[model samples]
Target chain A: MKILAAVSRSTVARVLNCIQVLVPKPHVAVVSLDEEAALASKAMGVEFIGGPLPEKIYAIDEFKEYDVGIAALDNDSINISVVKALRSIGIPLVISLLNNSANRDLLVKEGADYVIDIDSYVSQNIAASLSMDKWVYVKPLSIVNLTLAVVRLARRSILGVKLGELKSALRSKSIHLMAIDRLGKVISDDSVELNAGDIILLTGIESEVYEASMDVEKLFRRHEETLARSFAESLRASTRPYG
Target chain B: MVFALKSRGKVSLIIYLATEKGVRNVKHIYKSIEDSISVVDTYIVYYGLGAFKQLMDIPAFHSEPPYCRGKAILSGVNLVTSPVIVVINGDTSCFSIDSISNAVAKVLSGETLLHLSKPQTNTDFTNVYRSFLQDILGELGITQSMLYPSYSIIVGLRKFFTTTPYSMWSIEQLAAINLREEALVVENNSCIDSTIDYVKGFEKTFVKDLARKAVEIALQRNTISRNRAEEYLKRIEAA
Candidate 1:
């Protein structure tokens, strides 16, 4: 994917580096006023497009190649303006990083797709970690208004139950069981019995996922701390080619 | 440990140093791996002479200007007396004993022609530095062993480096490319991280030029077929 990271701070260099990592085969072009940010992005194989930040995203010829535009300017006003400019240019998706929380509503109104309030995101995240559902990993799938959850079954009643048995519950809740992360080898096979250290990945509408997550905690040794450690071990082992 | 025991003074270690951070990393790496009885000697390959004023006692080579990764490594490889040599990226953040010892063992055991690592702690985060033409380079039958020079900590036979030499911006890639199927991949945390300040300005055209030159070098080495290289050249140009 062609990504235009219109950055204003050197700190965004690490963010750009991360984008390049998470997004597979990303063609990231960073437009930054800061020389440090520009040079750092270039070093990470991201193209440092040198030019004044134009009113419209397409004004820079290289940006026309990019479908997604991210406005990460330091000021909320600039971010709003860049987001508006990007939206005007018909960029498929325009995401703005709101530095201040006060202008969030206005920024959201102006920025069509997303106005990410980093402060709120972090605080809410910290809040979530302290909640009763802390054992379950939940990430909001924004575009669809759905939630993807990884739930560890806390009880032993789920043992000997085939994965197929959960399909009925999943169907009733309208939440799909995406994959079973057992010691990290993500199993899509329903034939596999619900085993210890299995963390089930569920996705559906928010209400349904929450309901499923609560229900999942009642059965099997998909216990919280157990799967978190073992599943992580599996994932680490899988990514390491030598091991 | 057995590898170190069997290969005493039979293996030489060369650390490729480029940035200022690499100078410190080299000293850290030297001190960490100093007691390995398997290593015959340690060589520091820096960018220039001035970079090594404080780095006394260890024999070092200095490469001047327009830093080419291939030239720096091959130059050091040429001077090693050991049958096997391990070329490490000096910018790597602390080499662990486990990683170094395992690689040495693997090479000395004659299990593989070249042993390379996928840096879990690498600065780039991912193997994002995989050859620019990686998507299609496989079709051309050219495989890259060392995707990023920073992750180019490799243990291999000395003859492999002395022969089949191609020095461009991607000498390490070409070396791994030449290894073909004989390269072993080990997961290690020894790679330049984001903390290192190795910032160098480069334009798209310059990068494209480097890729073209890389393709040309591969074509010359018969590692890639002429037709495949031509197709890639066209594709790269269009891109």
Candidate 2:
């Protein structure tokens, strides 16, 4: 889809970089709150136009020259206004960026076909990060309350700890181990041991989910401390130069 | 021992193991589920993480080699029966309960599970720093606040600097694991609730501009007739 994103200069640039990865490279038109951003976006292979809400509406005309009118601006009001204006023009599919919680209903009432909230996106990132067994993925569930995440286990300093022990520790926090993703399948077997780099598909409450995430970190820390102690002891016994 | 259970004939039993966080509320959800469906055999697991930890004390539950892919599946054979597995997530918060309930129900119904939760909001440091910037600009009695960045800029920058790398890493990891079988059930009540706050601001400025831009872009692309574009422009101007 041809996406016209109206954002600040810096955000426009960042969006330009991120969009290529999130979606197919479309005819991206960058509209900024500043004029320089417009020029920069055009130079960066995005259709650039400058101006704030309402006034910036004039720039949308430029995109019509390219046979696409679908646009999503960063500002909720601007996107809604743009969508409303397009609706009157009988345009189809006007999506707005709804940044605040207060405006969601109003935007829907005002005729926003789709509203993308950045805050919600961020929360999803945080959830994703919590789900990570390896390095954290900051935005795990952007779709809100309807996501299943599969995360790989990180290489922990703690080795040989049974899955049963870990589960017990996590159980104290009310976290449940839904299924373990090992090799390439989901294992619900209770007898399975958790190995380093094993992927776990965890399902639970948000806080519990986060708590379960912390348990993995705690296990790693405990393992690392144990390993360090043993390594020191071995070094002392061997009289080897401790690196 | 509080146990929240729900089941449909011929389907898996969906249960939410209650914890102190929302053990009280779990009764309500449990009742609601029971009212909706016929629950089969049920078991009461002790509430709290301590109980779970103790349960794990059993050697059979301990981590071991060869890995147990659920007793029901075996090498070119199947053994254990598919008794409704009451999967419990240790989320005690109300939000967690709701999310877990939704996920479990979906799984039991043979639906794909998707993780659902509220979207994270940006902490408005702009408003905080806005006052500081406004104070600096106040010396000249020029309260225009142009020196201050917009909330979008602040949010965009924060996301770019802090969240981008993490998101990229996650996407990469998800790709590597490639486990696409199980369905993820998610709840978006918080998302829907939060959007109400920004509606007015959106209606006043952002929506207005967005409407105008839609027309402009349509006109620019020649996707719509000039007359239609002009009409759109007029409608927004009128609004």
DockQ of 1: 0.01
Q: Which ten residues in a row have the lowest lDDT in candidate 1 chain A?
A: A132-141
Pairs in steric clash, model 1: A153-A222, A155-A220, A158-A220, B123-B192, B123-B193
- How many pairs of residues in model 2 come into backbone collision? 84
**Residue-level lDDT tens digits of model 1 in B29-110:** 7766666646776777765325454465666555433265566676567545578887887865645667777777777777
Off by over 4 Å in 2: A1-3, A18-28, A58-74, A127-146, A149-243, B1-239
State residue B193's C-alpha deviation in candidate 1, in Å. Answer: 1.9
Candidate 1 lDDT over A1-243, as tens digits, reads 888888876457656866867746777878776788867876787788665453335467556666898888765545665776776677888888765454555566655487666644565566544443244544443356566666444354244556775675566688778555546777767787766556667788878888886766554334445666887999988895664
Please tell me the TM-score of chain B in candidate 1 relative to the true structure's chain B.
0.78
**Model 2, C-alpha of B34: deviation from truth (Å):** 47
Candidate 2, A1-243: lDDT as tens digits: 666665664456666776667555677666666776776677777766666544455545654433233334544434554555555544455556555433455456556666566655676567655554453323233335323334566554136555666666677765456545556665656666666667655555665666677776687678778888999999889895758
Native A-B contacts reproduced, model 2? 0.00
Q: After superposition, how far is residue B149 of candidate 1 from its true place, in Å?
A: 5.2
